[model samples]
Target: MTAIRTLLVANRGEIARRVFRTASAMGIRTVAVHSDPDAHAPHVLDADRAVSLGGSTPAESYLDAAKILDAARRAGADAVHPGYGFLAENAGFAAACAAAGLVFVGPSPESIAAMGRKDRAKEIARKAGVPVLPDAPVTGDDPDGWAVAGADVGFPLLVKATAGGGGKGMRLVTGPDGLAEAITGARREAAGAFGDAAVFLERHLGFARHVEVQVFGDVHGGAVHLGERECSVQRRHQKVLEESPSPAVTPELRERMGATAVALVRELGYVGAGTVEFLLDEDGDFFFLEMNTRLQVEHPVTEEVYGLDLVRMQLRVAAGEPLGLDRAPEPRGHAIEVRLYAEDPANGYLPAPGPLHHYAHPTHPGVRFEDGVAAPGEVSPFYDPMLAKVVAHAPTRAEAAAMLAGALDATEVHGPVTNRAMLAALLRDPDFLAGETRTDFLDRHPVLLAPPPPTPEVVHLGAAVAVTAARRRAADPVTSLAPPGFRLLPGSAPATARWTPIGGEPADVGYRLGAAFGDTALTVTVGGTTTELGLRDLGPDGVRVVHDGVAVPCIVRVHPDGSVWVNDPAAQSGWRPEPRLPDPELSAAAAGPVAEVPGTVAAVLVAAGDQVTAGQKLVVLEAMKMEHPATAAADGVVAAVHVEPGQYVEAHTVLVTLTTGPTA
Candidate 1:
């Protein structure tokens, strides 16, 4: 076996950090490649050596095979770990590494090419005696041909991009009339995401459970399976939560599925880490979906149960060592993992990228936090909105679910909007608790999507306490020149503050300072109720406000418009202080439609002087690998277009103006 002395991770974020941790433990020097925006990223700082890929976008940096190879050569790296996504499953990248005499820590280029396309992979599985769902032949650019093929595949089918995975380039067509549009949209998404627009039709199983078997193979011809992970909890066909030891999978079925995965790996002569995905129906019959010829994003749940580091196994296998496993070990316990993303669940789950001012993770037994960005860092609009993955393990499925739920409840992310509350609610959902999760879980239970907002009293009180504390600090004469041991004396006079919640009426708060609890301790009265509040300064821009023994950590930023943006675990709200002055420009622009999330304008459907109807699509913005259409508010003439195609805009930026002519 050839030993790899130095390895270069050809990706970024948590996956890169994960590979580096394993490589360092194995006494291998690790190299990191980063883009311009990720110059100070945690993964770069953790590596022994780092090289700049230069550009910010994926094509210019992570996905550029030439640049990655150059970085590897400069760092003297003997091997490259793709670490999933970007170029992880790219056959050309694997071939390039092989040609450069550098070990690619994955299956061979031939295996990747064989399994990269869903249509081809299904054919391979069918040939190997694995059951596969009936699928239409790959469609060409002709729209009529696509329509005909889709009809034969049947209605309620899925238009799937052959070249890539993830929900991108995938569309669910319930009828024949929508086939052409679905095909076009799928192709556009596929071409943008994977550089390929080839698509095919597949029989869509509306309520099937998404289960996949994790398989490992070595160059020595040894292969094994690490059981299965249930990934039925999804949104927009993308997995949100994953768990190992699926409730639907029994010992007999697990063995059968495991055997099937191993057989396919052996047939393909695959090496290194790979995942064999399958769709399990209610009758317990499973059909092969496709094989992901690389590590999965949800691999942690499998690793947690098996008590093994899959990355370490990948390294050993890439070095040409045997798996050393005659039979797969039985998973000891249960594990659950949820992806934490910077998206607003209340607003159609739109991507919400901003600075993470007060990021805190839960510290509990059997809890793991794999994060990409540290607090005080910006979640850039250029990449996926996923910030971290939180996983929990326990001796039982119920316990694991509860533990993960609690971990999410305790975790505080106070900057951009996140799906923390929604994920926690899903874990506690009755159907989820009963293991009735399916691919349409979210669609069936829309209530779990938008979590209830915090109590009005909590918001008002929290804001009052925060504002009062800030004012108190500023009012003190010694605040700017205080000594290390200096403490502010309690004041007798009550402090009064008035502020209006974003969508609520103005509130008047009266509070008096008491003994210090770091910053200020006060009893605030609002809306005929008084509650004790303890405010502690976390940093220049953050505070920990405690009420009734529960702490609410928040980051409070005051904009130039005299508005306070309070980001807290309870919720996010903007408060305007008393005597709120309106800007005429902003007030006039408010009549038009504004973007709900930060993204680049993909298309401006309406130009100045165009007549539009209410709810008509006016602009399409792309963010976080999804497109959001901003529609006109009322029937009117387009007075102006604020943003053009390819222009990046922030959340709530007005993109179009309209003249309603006597009505709006």
Candidate 2:
């Protein structure tokens, strides 16, 4: 059998780190390829050696097949492991590796090319006796013609990109009126994400469970299915959470689906790790959705239950080792995995890429935190915003869910806005707890998407307490005496500080030491309310605040921008000291049309002197692989266009100026 002594990982972030862990355990040397922004990335430090790809975007770095092949050759890697995303499913890249005399740890190039096209894969599945969806025949690229074809397929249909997965280039058309626009947008997104603009229409099931079977094939043609993962909890057609041994799937159904997945892979002569996705209707009938010819992001959930390392298995199978499994192993426990992203769920799930000043994971039994970024790292806009995957395992599904929810609640992430709170809320959602999750879970439960913002008073109190704690630590006797304005003097007026919470007015905070709790207690006044809090310093950045006899652990960090960030179990707040100038320039932009998220201007629908009605679509901004249409707030004449198509814009940047029209 051929042996892989050294392996080159042709991916970035968590997936790269994942492969390196497996390679190190097997006594194999690991090499990593990184872009300029990722030079200090966690994965780069974890590798034996690293090559510089020297580009910020994926196109110039990770997706550059030539650069990757060259790096592998330079590192003298015997095999190339594409750890999902980037070039993982790229047939051309796999073929290039084979030409370079390097083993590719994935399916054959021929198999990838066959399954890459959704329309062609459906035909193959049908021929293989697998139940397939009745999709509309792909017409030309014209939107008008596609709209007509979509009518025949009926309303409530899905426009899916043929070349890629991960919710990119996929749109749901609820009616005929939106069919053309949906098709056009889908094509643009698909082309940008996958380099393929071709799309097809499929019937959208109103109520369905998104289930996929994990299958592995060896070069010797031996294949088996390792059960199913229920990925019904989704937002914007992207899976947010995945669990193994779906609560809905019975033993008989699992066998039927597993057998079909294995038979299809064997017929296609596939090898390595792959996932066969299906949609289970309300009546329990299942239909083939598509096949991913590479490792899936949710593979860890399967690994946890099956007690197998899928990545290690990939390496062994690529080295010409047979799976040697006569039958699939039964899963012993339920595992749930949640994708942690640098996104703001309250704001249309817009990506929030920024610094991660204070990042900490929960440590507990049956919990696994697989992350890519360490604290003091920046989440760049050049790649996907997913920071990590938190997985939890337990003997029962309820226990697993409860354990994951608590872990998420206790986890701390500062700097960039994240979906941690929303994820925690979803885990504790009544419908979710009842196992009634579906593809439209988020759509049905809008409240879960945007949890109520922390009250102004709560945020103000948290920030003030955090700042007070920092001052107390800095004034420790061993370091130095308390600074001016902070030193407590007998009969002296209380020390006062002015701070503002995000989106809130400035709050006046006054604090003085209280005799009841000695020097550790502070009588703090926020806004106009006064309260006594018992504080214990837990080192430099941590404090235990006793409020109403309940001890609450809080971590605080001072950001480079002079903002104090407070993270507690119940709330998180970023407080900034009142500015002297009040930033009048920024205030002027707030009166006009501004980008809601940082993104590139894809289309500018209005120009100077154009008259528009209220709610008219003005510009289309693309961010995090999704397009956001910015519209007019009132009927007005466009006075100026501040941004042009193809220009990058930041959040709150004015994109257009308008002069409101006189009311009729």
TM-score of each: 0.87, 0.91
12: Cα error in model 2, Å = 0.4
Model 1 lDDT vs. the true structure? 0.83
In angstroms, the error of model 1 at 265 is: 0.8
lDDT of 2 by residue, 598-634 (tens): 7788789888888888888899887767788888888
Looking at model 2, which ten-residue stretch has the lowest summed lDDT? 479-488
The lowest-lDDT stretch of 10 consecutive residues in candidate 1 is 480-489
Residue-pair clash count for candidate 2: 0
